[model samples]
Structure formats: structure tokens, C-alpha cells
Target: MSLKSTHFHSGLTTHLIRRGSLTMSYPRDPNPTKETFGVGARWDVPAEKVHEVWVGNEGCEYVIGE
Candidate 1:
């Protein structure tokens, strides 16, 4: 399964696979932002430090909030 989130500004969708926890961007436009399109489209964070994955207009962030 996947965890999906939508960006407020771009309205693009970003997802993370529960298996690998890899961040991915699902663009809805022909020309998408760098964070939502391109060859290097996925990112992985250290699971220990990641409180959660946040998908925003700026892209996925490793939430470290307490």
C-alpha cells in the first residue's frame, strides 16, 4: 500500500510506499516542478530520524517534530 498526500499550491500528489518507504511524486501536469518530476524522483530518509513523511508544495520532508 501507499501513503498519499496532496500539495496545497501545485495540487500534485506525493506518495510513499509502506514497504520501502520511498517518497514519490505523482504529477498532474505536462510540465511539473523539480520536486514532482525528473529522473531523480524519489528520496529515502533514515527511518530512525523520520517521525513522518510530509508531502507539501515544496516536496516531501522528514518530519522530526516532537
Candidate 2:
């Protein structure tokens, strides 16, 4: 049902759902199955184009940049 990945520094387990591919994150809670937490997105970029990558991590996708 999900593709899981581990982040050592964060000590959090990330799972990628196969349906919509939505990413979910947990605070390494002791009870993973019963604990619900926030989520984040992941992307793969080339070294040459790293600077050009942009994401609306804070959920501000509507406000235009002045």
C-alpha cells in the first residue's frame, strides 16, 4: 500500500503512497501506527538545476510574488 523510506538525521519514517503518491512524515513517534503527523514532498533534481527548483512548502501557492 505504501513505499517507505528512512531518514537517519530526522529519525522519521517517510512513506510514499502508491495511489496519489502523497508523502507523509512522522516525528519518529513511539507508536507509528496510532500516531498521525504532517507530511512533506520529495523531488529529484540535477546538480546543474538545483537552484531553479522551487516548492510551496509553507502552503502559499496563491499569493503572487511582488
Candidate 3:
């Protein structure tokens, strides 16, 4: 009795939020270098003051209307 096989691919879900994805990877070079994500926004100003700003030199990032 000998059965041992391991080659795997099955974990993809998007816009469905069971693990909501913009593509993530971890299975030894399944292709994903670095694609980070984090954005939060809340603004009507005059509440801690910071109106419009922008900065994205590495890839993309925003926390506008601080």
C-alpha cells in the first residue's frame, strides 16, 4: 500500500469575500512577487485637518483626506 502524490493547485476566490482576493500566492513560485493593499478614506475635512494628498512611488497607496 503506497500512495503518495503531492502537486497542488486549488485556492482562488475573488469578489466573493470568503477570502476576498486581488490575487495572492504562496505555493513555491506560483507567481506573486509583491502586491500589497491597504486603503482607508474618510473625509469632510475640518475634523483633524488634511484635505488632499497623493503619494505612490513604490506601487500605489492612499490615505487621502486625512
TM-score of each: 0.22, 0.22, 0.20
Per-residue lDDT of candidate 3, residues 1-66 (tens digit): 112222322332222112212222233444534232334322232332212222233333223222
lDDT of 1 at 25: 35
Candidate 1 CA-lDDT value: 0.34
Say which prediction, candidate 1 or candidate 3, comes out ahead on TM-score: 1
CA lDDT of 34 in candidate 2?
Answer: 24
Candidate 1 local Cα displacement, residue 32, angstroms: 7.4
TM-score of 1: 0.22
Relative to the true structure, how large is the alpha-carbon lDDT of every model? 0.34, 0.28, 0.27
lDDT of 1 by residue, 1-66 (tens): 245644332233333322222333335445543233223343342323212222444443332221
Better of 1 and 2 by TM-score: 1
What is the model-wide C-alpha lDDT for candidate 3?
A: 0.27
Worst ten in a row by lDDT for model 1: 45-54
* Leading candidate by TM-score: 1
lDDT of 2 by residue, 40-63 (tens): 333332222211111223321221
Least accurate 10 contiguous residues by lDDT in model 2? 45-54
